[model samples]
Target: MDSFSGSSRGGFAPRGGRGARGRGGRAPFLTKTRETNPDLEKHPLGCLIKEFGSPDLGLNPVDLAKISDCQYVASYNWLNDEVPTIVIPGKPPQWTPLQEPQRLKEDSGQYFRDPNAAMYPDYPMAPVVNAVLETDSEFDAARTDVFACGSTLGNLLRFARGIDKAFRFNVVVIGDTVFFMRKDNDPREVIKDVRGFGHTFPEAYTTWEHSVKGSETHQRIIRYKFGGFSCLVRFESDGYIPDSSAVTNTTPANTAVGQGDLFQAFQGATISQQPTINKLGSLKIKQGGSPVPQKSIFDLKTRSGKYKKDIDMSDILPQLWINQIPNFIVAYHDGRGLFEDIRVRDVSDDVQAWVTDNSDGIRRFATLLDKIVDIARSNSDKLLEVYCPGKEHLEVREQYGDGAHALPADLRDGLDGSKDGDGGDISDGDEYYDSDEYGFDNRSDDSSEELDYTACSAHDCGYCGKCTY
Candidate 1:
């Protein structure tokens, strides 16, 4: 949470021999100075903090404190030049030389030199969210309440509450379904990316913002589930929820296929017919009819006697369904806006439909990809009809229509001109909701430009003079 200082600005000169130790025997290098950059402070993020100040969002400090005390077998502290240490609580920590310390040192040295590379003490994603919820408060009431409600971020809170919480980014739950929110590293980068969603979702350009406000929002959302890929690790609390299907018990145990065979058989099954792992041979159940199949399934090898790589049925089955939840949510909610519809039943229905139709392509096609391509081909026209206008911009354009282009000369500035009402900026502050940084920024592009139309046909001449006028 420290504002990075300039290279020339005075900072704690690295403690000459050993780093300074503080309370609980932690490093002082983690200490942040009050130095603030005028330019950075002027940035939207800084301005918001100044205007809003920090408000307590009802999260607990103890939740975040638990992270620092969580047992980590191996600790990699870059602030200290000491070799990676083996951390055993109560015993003096022991350091081990890296296999190629020179390479590590060189790479890390250059990374630390980068101006944008701010140092963050190693910690799981959960505590960061908890800390932010408890401290930083700037988002709108609707957005802030999502986290304050607790249930919205319950799964994530669960992950962070545990010791050694596994880190997963962009994972969110809408209703009964949990989804991995897809996003580019940068929206500007997406504009330049030839294979980006910009073409499919032309309005996606405004999705990323480049300002400090955008940066802070991006950081908070990632901690609160926005962009970046997620890992579906096993937590003792809950298990993966895939579509329900009957497990055939008629198959003979002697003739049953091994885990390797089962995976191979179902690996290619359409997303709809994901392997309904009803049996695991000797690994099926525990003493009192409890299920513990991870170790056995992970140990299974391929038919050629090679260990199955990342093709484990255990993770793949759940992932097959887990990964698709977002798509269902997007298709159902995106016309309105991503995560805009937080209602559980609406979101859950979309998920159930997705699982029924896409998971086991038998309901539709052989695979989810095929279903998507087919749907796109079928709805290609409808998709083109929709434009990616910001919520405010779209309203303005709709009100004015084509005449919007030739609205009164004074009203030409789009929103600024109309006296009655123009779609106001999405958020407070001049930082337009940049699409480049994180989740949907409330603001829209200020510049007046014709909305880009995505077309699937060469026969119609709507805007461009290709086929017919």
Candidate 2:
């Protein structure tokens, strides 16, 4: 991160561009930067935070090669306000029955125990237990989330992988559920979003580091996410684990939906429920399926057959995002500021040179965002409490008693520059796991594999939304 010779200070640039005085003088939440393009709609990490690093380096097409080597990662942010009943089906206190846990043989030679027995509060009125009874969101009492090992993040290893991989931003899983707020055409608002993200997923996440007796101990776990979110996933030659609900290699029809892409993010929600989609009738499956009931948001003249507009998405660039797994823990963040965390296994003057040598725009930029995001994730924990709307569900939180907060010790120690038992030295240098191992690439090697975007039937007009062939 030290490689940049200019402007790489703090979280934002001190002067130049945008906030000249009034207007709140630089948004307290956004990291500001210099930009020329006016039509960027929106980029995942906010706007391009300042020219990546001076024109001396020249501009590179936003070629997503950097994240290609990304092995595993995740994004976390806390949302305030009640859990938003509109998103939950049937409004209040609606509970879905739990699924039966499957019995599996364990090397321990013991039958797999049901988690409902080990984790749920035995007390009938336990806060969490009570809250569940009052909230509309459904859950399988035996399984709180899809990823069960706890922390979805596991110590991963990547040797030398591939080169030509493309990079991605956040993995967004679109859903079928919608916040049915109104009965007619009207502006909709969002209090919280329900984007589900997935990766190999940790069974659970633990703040305390513990060693298992003659076994692989874990501290984190990931559950199946419900909306447009992301989770880290990796492919191993020795074994394969699919991230989506569909079977792997056996169902190409569902491959796109199951491949951890943005569309798949909508696991439980649907576009058909959106006012725009519901009115257009584009919400239903295209190839042909069981006929579905029709819906609408308003009694507009258009719905009265007064207007007609044809749209095509057959050719938009198809994208999927994956997080860069922490190869070597270098720094971390707390609510107050950024800290250091590193292990002693890889260190020394030579290592310092190696780190200093690779310093550039890419590394510097990623490191800064890393600190900023870590801080956000840390603070979010406070905002992410037991979400129970209405007085009846308050007991759920009371029972849970507000879960605790703790960051990874090794990661934190590595970020604290002066702390000793802090695991490793932060000043030594930044070390990414296996340079060639992380990053993304087009999913297929065959030139014949076309982009999944919808193409307009119009001639030579390319990707324009509407063009006649």
Q: Tens digits of per-residue lDDT for model 1 on 1-469? A: 1111100000101111111110000000101212111121221111110010012112222222111111111101112212111110011111111111010000000101100012121212222222222222331222311121111122122222221111111222222122221111211110110110111111111111111110100111211211111212211100111211211111112222344333322221111111011111111000010121221111000100011111112211222122121111010112211211111111223334433433222211112112222332343222111111111110000111111111122222221222224333222221112222223223322211212111101111111111100
User: What would the TM-scores of all predictions be?
Assistant: 0.17, 0.18
What lDDT tens digits, residue by residue, belong to model 2 across residues 74-181?
111101112110010000000110121111111010110111111111210111121221221232332221121110111000000111111111111112110000
Model 1 spans with C-alpha error above 4 angstroms: 1-121, 130-132, 135-204, 209-350, 354-469
What TM-score does structure 1 among the candidates reach? 0.17
The local distance difference test score of model 2 is 0.16
- Runs in model 2 lying further than 4 Å from the true structure: 1-247, 250-362, 368-469
